[model samples]
Target chain A: MEENEMRRVDLVVIGGSAGSFTVLLEILPKIRTDIDFAIVVVLHRKNNFTTSIADVFDQKCALPVLECEDKDRIEKGKIYFAPADYHLLIEKDSCFSLDYSEKVNFSRPAIDITFKNAADVYQSKLVGILLSGANADGAEGLAYIKQKSGTTIVQDPESAEIATMPNEALKLCKPDFIANVGEIADLINQF
Target chain B: MRIYTLVDDDDLETLLNDVANKYGYDFTEYSKASMKRRVNRLCTLDKFASFAELRYRVLNNDSYFARFVEEVTVNVTEMFRDQHFYKTLRDEIIPQLGVHSHIKIWLAGCSTGEEAYSLSILLHEANLAHKAIIYATDINPRVLETARNGIYPIHLIRGYSQNYINSGGITDFSDYYTANYDYARFVDKLREHMIFATHNLVSDSSFNEFQLILCRNVLIYFDKNLQDKVFNLFDASLENLGYLALGSKETIKFSHLERRYQQIGKEKIWRKMK
Candidate 1:
């Protein structure tokens, strides 16, 4: 894809597991509040009766943060975290849908499910970022984003807290950029 | 390898229309994202080769259509899911309902009877089992059969036990069921006040008025219009001051019935005011 022909990005999906919390804590606080696209974060988590990840992110992030609910309409300049124990999907009309179907790759909020769904909805206007994790959940989805001519970024495995996730993603498809957490934050600000 | 797309949007529309027109099971109002995923998964699981093949099998074969309905509507559920919600029911809701001479509770979308059994245990513990009658309903009859059996995998018992404890349950959770081989069959006494049946929230009318209605994690699969229709059905069926519960992420706040119901505490349970 040529730089001159790049489509206007409308959605950014970030997938991580294992040691990705520190990365998100560092990156979320740095995200500008005025970005034009909506952001969704998909992280592997246990089903807890209390204390959602969104509540924690809302305190530190510049933009409004929320846990994604069923049929929630996507909005610009906000961040949504996929709720635990359910696969979060993007409908064609840009609303969110939650599913309790069997987990993929031993995960409910599987990065690949959200990534592929978002890719189908946003097509060339999507950006998918895979960060530090111990599993291969996000690799195929990132690769799918690349196949759809959307922007793909993998955290530099050497700099990641755990390299397995990013390394697996790198093995699947060539991402547009491979950078550390700080560099990834900088790239997102430019979007 | 590219993730295959055997079923596209147009294909899904045609399939849903055919099923509704021929079979009267309308899935046109289901959330398309989940529906599409389930349909694609069915294709992969059944090895249909193509979307047209799957459509032909569904449209022509009654047994295959039954399988299709089972696959498309999600039935995954657990006992005492979201411990706090059950805790609220145990500490607050049950005590309030116990004051009534008899309790009628409707468990809509009660898949596999986990929740129905859980409610039975709560009522039994509160000494209200004799006065309570649970109407458990689902769109799929196969799951209703499972619910009626009161048998579940033994491995799930550990989690259910833990959730029961977390939900303020004090009695021996193990006493509720007897483990045989890989399955745990719940005591017959727990199944006494329960009635399991096939009830489609989409097209079915309410059969009885109730003091409490619990339909959790089911509405997420529906679109706004269908949700409103179901809510109206609930509104019509609920008695005055009866409680209506939804999934934790779901709400009645934005709907037309918002003004008629008041949310109790932070839980998704609401009380009808008018």
Candidate 2:
């Protein structure tokens, strides 16, 4: 962490695939609630079928959790999932627009979509977190967040269950924090 | 609560949900204007005076819902509808696509088959169709059926012919289809490499990887966030240095994926980073 740089954010967006569910179970538990920001998880939903991932995550965390719908308002302290097959895009107003469209990178609930949109909408005000994914989905998008001067974090490749995505991101862009999943969550709570 | 006439937005949503549950189709994430127009057309056919009335009817009537689903969700596309995009492909793009030994192209939201057929021709023209696999999908099952049929209203072909010419047609566009009284059944040969199926962009995960994906005209109806989301999906589905094609009016200016692609022309053709 940079001692000199300290600023609050409105929301957080995490992009992951393949091995993401367990990562959530590990990292979200240690986070503090004093920070005012919603956390959205954009994960790969292999089939279009909907699941209660947010609810499942809710059982593991202190914050509220729910699946996002079209035109959903983004509020602080809540955790939103990129509902089953929709791409979770962040509006300029910092709200959400869950869209039905062609799958990107072969995934509808794509990590890159949420990361990139959040980066564009929130810019320096946002924090983009990347974790385990099979493919290099979040690599360029993490680069984009850094380009916009937003904080970017990638789970340490060695700590990740599937490291292709995080490793590729590390290779392509220099993230602000490249840490173990537990450390990433600890930093979030402290931040 | 007594069922009364519903408002436009509410009625449309209700009807869409009804169609989804009964027919396994979902259009909840489609653009409002296009959905409105399509729903209006369906309502008119059902003799409903208002969106609410139409929606009410949809909830109770399976046959009308079937007809409504057919009317509202059809994409009404044909081969080479936008010649300029194809022209860009033939002239500036395809020549540069030789880096990958095998090519995969996905025609996302390929409503009613014209665009897929057009891509088939483009692939054949480029000598890549033989090796390339084209996956064409739509959320609407009826439309997917129509698309799989590879047939179109013959009246629309005259315009398609013009687009073909503008899109760098090297031969007669008519040579691609057999004209029935009112429909044109496209050539069977074009379907050889195509995998036409029902796939929803909003509610489906990607099933394959591709080198080039043409999802033009599909994202313009969505709001900004949705656009970025779909753009990300393209990033996931594509291989490194893959190409993504968006509609004429759409751009990646405000999207997070903007840096992932450089605009080749009117379309937003993207590449996955190496």
Candidates' DockQ values?
A: 0.76, 0.01
Tens digit of lDDT per residue, candidate 2, span B210-259? 88888866674465556667777777888777788875434566667767
The C-alpha local distance difference test score for the whole of candidate 2 amounts to 0.73
Candidate achieving the largest lDDT: 1
| Alpha carbon lDDT at A140, candidate 1 | 93
Give the C-alpha miss distance for residue A119 in model 1, angstroms.
0.9
What ranges in model 2 sit over 4 Å off? A1-191, B1-6, B10-26, B49-53, B180-182
> How do the residues B134-186 of candidate 1 rate in per-residue lDDT, one tens digit apiece?
99999999999999999999999999999999999898999999999999999
How close is every model to the real structure, measured as TM-score? 0.98, 0.54
